[model samples]
Target: MKIICTKSNLAKGVSIVSKAVPSKTTMPILECILIDATTDVIKLTANDMELGIETRIEGEIIDRGIIALNAKIFSEIVRKLPDNEIVIETDMNNQTMITCEKAKFNIAAQSGEDFSYLPVIEKEDNIAVSEFTLKEVIRQTIFSIADNDTNKMMTGELFEIDENVLKVVSLDGHRISIRKIELSDSYGQRKVIVPGKTLQEISKIIGGEAEASVEISFTKNHIVFEFDQTLVVSRLIEGDYFKIDQMLSSDYETKVRINKRELLDCIDRATLLIKEGEKKPIIINIGDESMKLQIKSQIGSMDEEILITKEGKDLLIGFNPKFLIDALRVIDDEEVDLYFMNAKAPCFIKDEQQSYIYLILPVNFNAVA
Candidate 1:
């Protein structure tokens, strides 16, 4: 198989599919990138069983054949090659030659017939969303997913589609992040749990073009994302998601409306006095029209006050500063509303429309340093 591709196009295709290449795999074929030039377009594919990616590049296919090359070496070679056309040819002895203007390198290749390909998914149950919106949603919620595998469901996000509204939710034991988006067209109701790894990779690959759309299709156990010249297929996490609606409440005895940036910066500064891995809660005293934040740790102590519009009742609460920072960093609003039910109940940070909601469980101040 022989194909002549420009360095820029080939490098882009390789970089996009390389996300699926496994760092360590018992099967060597899983570490290679399959190049299929038998069709009109030059296709590159990489699959690590759980996730698979395929992208087409614009190039000239001189010979109709297929070969698999090591993804690491191939990507490095293409990236370092001169900014010109690159010729890749495979011979009968399973040897692949990469040539540029003056540089040439030969590497062993594997037959593409032995490579595993992405599963074929039916496009009947599908939804179209703007590339920009999809990327933004993932960025705003992926951070809250559990990093451990003790609870499999916590490592993934729930994708629920009800008519024209799409809701994405991710939660760890300590906090929950929810983002709801409105779609342009309505479709059948569907719900699935997508692995966090797949969404993270897709976010990096998407160009974030507000006008461009991404077609997403779901089956019983698989999900597919198609955008531009690339496609991503991932295995769905099987199980029922948590009933989050019951945990959300609109009742609050106290409410505070404060500048988002000011509160975030105050929490950020308080965290500096606390040491890593130390259980020091940021104690907040909410009064009539102001809130005071204080933190005491082994290293030192800090106290600050921020003016807020308060109503309902005055209260004292304690929370993990990291949780507050995480939710605040993702929010784009100039001011945010916080609802509290006594000092033990979880805090709710959101807007009036409820487009985004963050629930953070409070820490016990008596036990915290």
Candidate 2:
């Protein structure tokens, strides 16, 4: 394979496809990116079996062929190159050579035949989603997905596409986050659990572009995203996502409306005093027109008070300070509507506009120090 590509263009394409490269993949071919030189375009592909990404860039293709080169080496070489067009070629011995202005490199590369073919989605149920809106949904929900891989479903973010309204949900058995956006288009209805890593890749590709919509497809066991020339494929988790409404509280013993920024700042300060791995529990005492926030850990303690509008009886609740911070961040309004069934049940935080709701399980202190 022989191809001439500009360093800047190659760098961008490599960066996008590198998201699918496996760090510890036993299959050497999976760690290497497939570089193909067609008549007018150069294609780069990387995959870790379950997820794959392919991106193409305009290049001067002297010969029509393909080769698989180590993604790590190829990316590093491109980064080090000066601002100039570079030529890459694969000889009969199966070694790949890279040459720029002064620097040159040759590395043993695997034949393109050894590289696995990227999967193709034969039929796609197309839907148009605003890239900006989609990116925010990913940011809010992806962070809440469980980092543990033991349970597949828990590691994925639940996506419910019902008609024109799209709902995104995520949880780690401790807290739950749900964000809903009502669109103006007729998208029909569907639900799928997309892997967190896949969503991260898609979000990275979508920048601050004025593109009206990003195309997406939900297949049986996989989800496909087509944004311009790049395509991302991710395998869907097989299982039912947690029922969000089931974890919500029906009644509230205490309710308060507090400034979201103040509460977030309090938690940020309190988390510092809490030791790592130690439950960073922050006590919230809600009363008439005010709320007291305090945290006590082995390292130190913190306390603060924020004015609020309280309508129910006063009650104290303990929660993971960090979880509350995440839930509060999704609310764009100045104040957040808080509700708790009791000290033991999970608390619900909603936007004053009643557009988004976040639920967090309360921490039970058998004995408060």
Candidate 3:
């Protein structure tokens, strides 16, 4: 294979496909990226069995062929190449040569036949979403996915699509995050559990183009994402997602409307005195038109008050500062409503439209210092 492409374009293509290359795998071919040169387009592909990524870059194809190169070394070399066009070729001896301006390097190449092919999804069942909106939805709920959980399904998010409305949900035992959006076009009804790691990588690839759209398709066991010049396929976790709607209740003994940033800042400051791994609870005493936040730890204590517009009965609740901070940080709203039923039930934080709902289980004050 012989191809010539600009340094920036080559680097970008390599970066996108490298996410699928496994850092440690028994199959050596899985660590290498397959570079295929056709008549006018140069394609790069990487697959780790479960997740696969393929992208094409516009380049001058001198020789139409294919070769596999070490992704780690190839990416580093392309990233540091001189600000000039890069020429890559594989000789008969199976050695890959890279040249850009004055720099040159030779590395052993592997046969592209050894690399596994990416899964191909039939496009009959597909949905379209704005790139910016999908990125935002993933960002808003991905954090709530359980990390290293024994129940593998909890480590992923639920993509529940009904007609034109799409709802994304993630929960980690302690809190549940749900974000719903209405799509411009409908793809009927579908539900799938997408791994959190896959969404994390997809979010990175999506640039800040709000108008650009992503085409998504789901099969029996895998989900496919296509946008721009890239394609991603990820295996879906098999299990029924928890019925989260029943858990989110509108019953509340107290409702307070407060500034999201102000509450976030107060909880963040209170956590300063708490040490790592310590289960410190930020006690919130909600009163009429105002609330006081306090945290007590072995190092010291912190207390602050923020004014709010309160209704119903007064309540005092304790919660993990990190949980509250996580929800508040992602919210783009200026004012938010916090609903509570005494101090035992979960607290709900959401906007007026209820487009995004965060239900956090309060910390048991009896167990904290």
Candidate 4:
């Protein structure tokens, strides 16, 4: 295979595809990136069996052929090459020669036949979303997905598409983050569970440009996300996602409205005195006009008072300070609404606009009834 391309364009294309190349794998062929060259476009593809990315760069293809080269060596060499036109050609003996203005490098290459076949994006059941809106939606919810390997389904975010709204929900069994955005055009109905890493990468690849658009769709086992000259095909977390409808309680006896920044600060300050491995959860006392957040550890403690509008009798509850702070950081609204079903039941939180709902399973402090 042979191709000539500008340094910056090649560097950008290789950098994105390299994210899927496995650093170490038992199979030897998985370490190489498959490069396909035609007269008009050059395609670079890499996969670690779980996630894969393919990018097409606009370059002059001298010959129509395929070659697989070591991803590590090729990427490193291209990144440092001068910002001038570079030429890469493969010899009959499977050796790749990289040439720049004053430097030449030779490395052994392999045929593309040895590489695994990447999954094809079969159906184009597409949806349209602006780059900025989708990027912000993923940023607001991706942090709360589970880090451990307990329940496989819970480790990823549940994305549902129906009619005119796209919803993202993530839970670690203790705290759940739910977000919703109205669609620009009705795209019919579809549902898929995308892994957290894929969502994070796509969020970054979008580059926060509001004018750009992403074409989204899915097959049975994979999801295809297409953007400007870049495509990400990620394996889906196939299974039934837990139903959030029944998981959250509908009955509420108390409601408190407070400033979002003030509540987040109160929880962060309370967490400072609570030492690691200590059972010192933050105690929240809610009344008619004010709310108090306090934490008492062995050596130190914190007391914070925030103004609020409450509508029921006074109540006190215990919650993990770290979890509370995490949920608060993702909210974009200025004010937050808190719901209670007693001191022992799970507490629900929503923005002042009531657009999205968050639930936290409270810690039991009183003796069992």
Candidate 5:
């Protein structure tokens, strides 16, 4: 295959497709990126079995052919190439030549026939969301996704669409994050568990521009995301996600309204006294007019007070500093409402519209010695 394209375009194409390339795999073909230039547009694809990405770049296709090249090497070469036109050609001997202004390199290429292709997902069940809104939802909840894959469902986010409302939910064992948005057009009812890796990568591919949109389609076992001349197909985590709604409760004995920034800064400062590997709980004592925070660790202890508007009964609670900080950091509002049923029950943080809800389980008061 032979294609001539600008260095920046080629670099971007490589970067997008490279997200699916396995760093190391027993199947050597999975480490290579398939370049197809059979038509006027040049297409690049990579699949690591679980996640696959394909994108097209505008270029002049001199020879109608296809080849597979090492993703790492090709990406590095394209990235370092000068800001000039790039010419890529493959020969009969399966050797790939890459040329730029003053840099030229030749590498052995693999047969494109051996590379895996992204599975075709039917468009029967699909939803279109503005790229900006989708990105925002993912960002607000992605952090709550479990890092460890032990619980497959927790490692992914739940996309539940009912009528015109799109609800995205993610949670580790400690906390749950939910974001709700209303779509301009109703897309019917659907539910899918999307892998965090897929959403994270798609977030990077999508620009923050509010106008553009992404069309997402789902199959029985896979999900496809199409946006900006790119397509991503990923395997969905099997099984039903946890019923998180039951865990949220409006029965709170204490409700406090505080500035989001002030609470975040207080928890962040308290974390400083905590040593690495220490699971110290940040104790919060809520009163009628102010909330006090206390953290004790081997390094030291910290105490800070922030004024708050309180309703209901006064309460004292303890929580993992990181949990509160995580939820607080994502909130865009100037002030936040926090609800607590008791010292032992989970603490809830959300806005007035209930567009976002963050539930964090409090630690035992005795746990923080």
Candidate 6:
């Protein structure tokens, strides 16, 4: 394959598709990025079995052919190349040559025929969301996704579409994050479990422009995201997601309204006294007018008080400070409402409209104190 394109366009295409290149793969072809010049526009593709990305770049196709080159090497070469036109050509022996203004490199390439391409996904059940909204939703909930594979469902987020509402849910045993968004148009009901890795990659690629939009299509086993000149396809995690409704409660014995920044800062300061991997919990005592937060750890201790508007009854609870910080950091509200059911039930931070809901389980007061 032979293509002549500007360095900027080529580098952007390579960076977008390289996200799917597997770091450790048994299949050698999976580590390469396929460059297809048979069509009008140059197409770059990378697939690591579970996820695949394809992006089109404007370039002059001198030869109608295809080849797969090492993603790591190609990306590095393009990134370091001078700000000039780039020419890539492949020979009969699969030897690929990259040339810029004054630099040239020859690398071994593989046949594109053996490269795995993205699967065909039906575009029937789809919805359009602004890039800004989608990126914000992923950022707000991705931190709660489980890092381990112990529970596969918890490692991914639930994408549920009912009418014009899109609800995203993610949890990691300790806390649950839910974000609801309203779409401009309504579509068929669909539910899918999208892998956290896929969403994280898409978030990075999307520019989060309020005017730009992304079209998402969902099939039985695959989900497709199309935006700008790029397309991403990922296999959905199998099995039904956890029934989160049963775990979420609407009842609370005490409710307190506090400044979001004040509470977040208090918890963040308390974290300083606790060592890494320590199981210390931040104890919160809610009174009629103010809330006191205290943390005692091996290194030291912290005690602070923040004024709050209280309703219902007074309560005391303990929770992992990290969980609170994660939820609070993403919230854009100036003030937040906290609801508690005695001291053992989960604490909820949400607005009256329920646009965003964060549920964090409390630790035993005695266990920490």
Once fitted onto the true fold, the runs of candidate 6 whose alpha carbons sit more than 4 angstroms away are none
Query: Which candidate do you rate higher for lDDT, 1 or 2?
Result: 1
Q: Write the per-residue lDDT of candidate 3 for residues 1-369, one digit (tens) a residue.
A: 789999988999999999999989998899999998854678999999989999999889988888999999999999888989999999887799999999999999899877898977776588888899999999999999999868798899999999898999999999999999998887678889999989999999988488898989899999999999999999999989999888989888899999888999889888889889999899999998899999999999888999999999988889999999999999998989999988999999987778999999998887875
Clashes of 3: 0
Computed on alpha carbons, the lDDT of every model, listed in order, comes to 0.96, 0.83, 0.91, 0.83, 0.91, 0.94
* Model 2 steric clash pairs: 163-188
TM-score quality measure for candidate 2? 0.95
Please, what are the lDDT tens digits per residue for candidate 5 over residues 11-80? Answer: 8999999999987899989999999987777899999999999999988988989999999988989888
The top-ranked prediction according to lDDT is: 1
lDDT of 4 by residue, 4-24 (tens): 998998888888888878878
List residue ranges in candidate 1 displaced over 4 A. Answer: none
The TM-score obtained by model 1 is 0.98
Per model, how many backbone clashes are there? 0, 1, 0, 0, 0, 0
Provide the lDDT at 25 for model 5.
94
Candidate 4: count of backbone clashes, pairs at least 3 residues apart or interchain: 0
| RMSD of each predicted structure | 0.9, 1.7, 1.0, 2.6, 1.0, 0.9
The reply for model 4, stretches above 4 Å from the true place, is 274-279, 352-354, 365-369
- TM-score of candidate 5 on Cα atoms, chains taken together: 0.98
Instruction: Note the residue pairs that clash in candidate 5.
Output: none
lDDT of 1: 0.96
* Span of 10 residues, lowest total lDDT, candidate 5: 119-128
